[model samples]
Target: MKLTILGCYSATPRILTNPTSQVLEMRGNMFLIDCGEGTQVQLRKHKIKFSRIKHIFISHLHGDHFFGLVGLVSTFRLLGREADLHIYGPKGIKEIITLQMKLADSWTNYNLIFHELTSNDSELIYEDDKVEVYTIPLEHRVYTNGFLFKEKEGNRKLDINAVEEANIDVAYYRKLTQGFDVVNENGETIKNEDVTKDAVKPKSYAFCSDTMYKEDIVPLIENVDVLYHESTFLETQSHLAPKTKHSTAKEAASIAKKANAGTLLLGHYSTRYKDVNCFKEEAKEVFQAVELTQDGKVFEF
Candidate 1:
């Protein structure tokens, strides 16, 4: 899995960073996590194919998180893309988007599907043969949900030498890769363990932003391979953090520690602090594997 941070500044844009947007690439597809302002331009600058982004997951209705959505959709229309697009967001998002489309008298020439989320509990919103997406309810100023993207386990590796030694037929290759026993032409059984190994462990990523300290969501993203959590403030400004329904670096690390995440990538830094090392130091107090996200930096897992 690959994560490209398009914007990382909090509250407002900075000379160095934009707002809050991230592109997650997996399974030969791009899944946009947030569409902050200038997202389309970031997509272009990063050389990511816009048409490959069929699924979009919005964390909340906050302007910093979704302001670039309409522009992106319009750009797709202008580009003459006809593929179906799936958007998963809060309940009011579809209405806002459709209203924009109605007022402009411009409609996308493709299938647009909206999955509105209203529940406060964790729920599966998308699933396919290769990946699954779930909502992680978060404590924020408004209704908010973090998204968990998980890639399914791959098929078992085939032992070609073992298969050849066993005189395995080509017709049984598929079954062997699926960890299924193969029946020989002579009515003999070839157990899957004899010619195949366990499947590769699946990878998972979790995105949490614009939320306060919430521990209930830990289980939903427990043991995630990578966790991107909002760290809008350092420990010294922790009081201001929760007062604004945001989290400090220490709080973000606590969640990562409880969830046992492999690595914690912190972003959404407030402009008050010129340096970001304070955040890294504070979070490291609880979680050892901590990293700061810079705009345009790509993290691979």
Candidate 2:
């Protein structure tokens, strides 16, 4: 899995920094997460193809999280896009986008599909053969959700020498790799485990931003390989966290420690601080593996 941070600041876009937006590339699919202002420009700056993004995920109705949605869809029309675009977001998202389009008399040329979510409980939102996505309900001023992306395990690896010695025909190689027991040329049943090794362990990523410190989400993201949590404030300004419905770096680290996440990534920083590395230091107090995020940073796992 590959993730490119288009923008990671909070509330407003700046000349040097931007709001929340990111792109995740997994299994030949590109997922645009949270289209803040200037997102398309960031995508262009990063040289990521607009056509590669078929699915867009919006965490909430907050302006910093989804203000760029209509602009992006209109751009797709300008480019003469033909492929369908799927948008997963809050319940009123469709109405909000449609109203603007109606007033401007500008409609998309491509199919626009919206999967509006209202459930408070965790649920599967998207799935295919190679990947699965689930919603992680979050606590914020507005109805919000985080996203979990998990890769599906592939077929097992074959031991060529063992298969040949077992008198298995080449025609049954596919079945062997699929973890199926098949009859050999000698009329003997071969066990899949005996000839094939286990497949590569699948990877998982969980993204939780623009939320207060909530323990309920820990179970949903337990043992996640990578976790990107919002650290909008530091402990020195921790008093502002609850009041503003945002999390401190220490709070984000506590969540990561409790969830047993492999690596904790810190982003959505408040512009009040001159140095963002302080977030990483405060987070490292509770979690050892901590990484800081900025615009144009890329992470591979």
Candidate 3:
């Protein structure tokens, strides 16, 4: 799995920073997490193929999170994109984008499918053979949701030597890998466990941004391989966190520590502090594995 940070700052864009946006590539899927202003430009900067982004996920109706969506939809049309695009966002996203297209008369030529989420509880929003995505309801000023992407458990691996010793036919190898016992060429019952090894552990990523210190989310993101939580402020300025419905670096770390996440990625910085290392330091006080996110940065796991 790989994550490319297009933007990670909070609220507004700046000369050196951008708003919230990112591209996550996993299990043969490229997912756009958000579309802040200049997202396409960032995509170009990273040399990510725009055509590969079939699914776009918006956290909320915040302009900083989704204002560039309409422009990107139009750009897809301009490029004569033929592939259908799927968009998942909070309720009113469809209306927000459709109204802009209505006023500009710039509807996408390709199919634009919208999945509007309205549930207060977490729900599976997208799934395929290899991956499943679930919504992580968040506490924000407006209705918001984070996303949890989990790779589907893989099939068992075949022990070639064990299978060969068992005199299993080549055709039965597939069955062994699928965790099924099969009759060998010699009419022997071959146990799957005897000829197959365990599959690789699947990876998981949880994106939780624009939310306050929400402990209920710990269960939803338990044991995630990577947790990207918003650190819009430092512990020193924690007073502003509740006021703005945002989380401090320490609070985000607490969530990560509670979730037992492998790594904690801090982003959506308030941009008030000139040094981003302070966020990492504060988070490290609570969780050791912490990384500060910046535009144009890439992380692979």
Structural similarity to truth (TM-score) of each candidate = 0.97, 0.96, 0.96
Model 2: per-residue Cα lDDT over 1-301, one tens digit each? 9999999999999999989999999888899999998999999999999999999999999999999888999899899999999999999999999999899999898999999999999999999998999999999999999999999998899998999899999999999989999999989999999999998888888999889999999999999999999999999999999998999999999999999999999999999999998999999989999999889999998
- Number of backbone clashes in candidate 3: 0
So what's the TM-score on candidate 2? 0.96
Ranking by lDDT: 2, 3, 1
Indicate whether candidate 1 or candidate 2 has the larger lDDT.
Answer: 2
Displacement of the residue 223 alpha carbon in candidate 2, Å: 0.6
Which residue pairs show collisions in model 1? Answer: none
Cα lDDT of candidate 3 equals: 0.94
lDDT at position 89, candidate 2 = 97
Off by over 4 Å in 1: 185-187
- For each candidate, the alpha-carbon lDDT, in order, equals 0.91, 0.95, 0.94
lDDT (C-alpha) at residue 174 in model 1: 90
Candidate 3 worst ten-residue window by lDDT = 169-178
Q: Considering summed lDDT, which 10 consecutive residues are worst modelled in model 2?
A: 196-205
Expressed as tens digits, the lDDT of each residue in 103-165 for candidate 3 is 998888899999999998999999999999999999999999999999999889998889889
Clashes of each: 0, 0, 0
* lDDT winner between candidates 1 and 3: 3
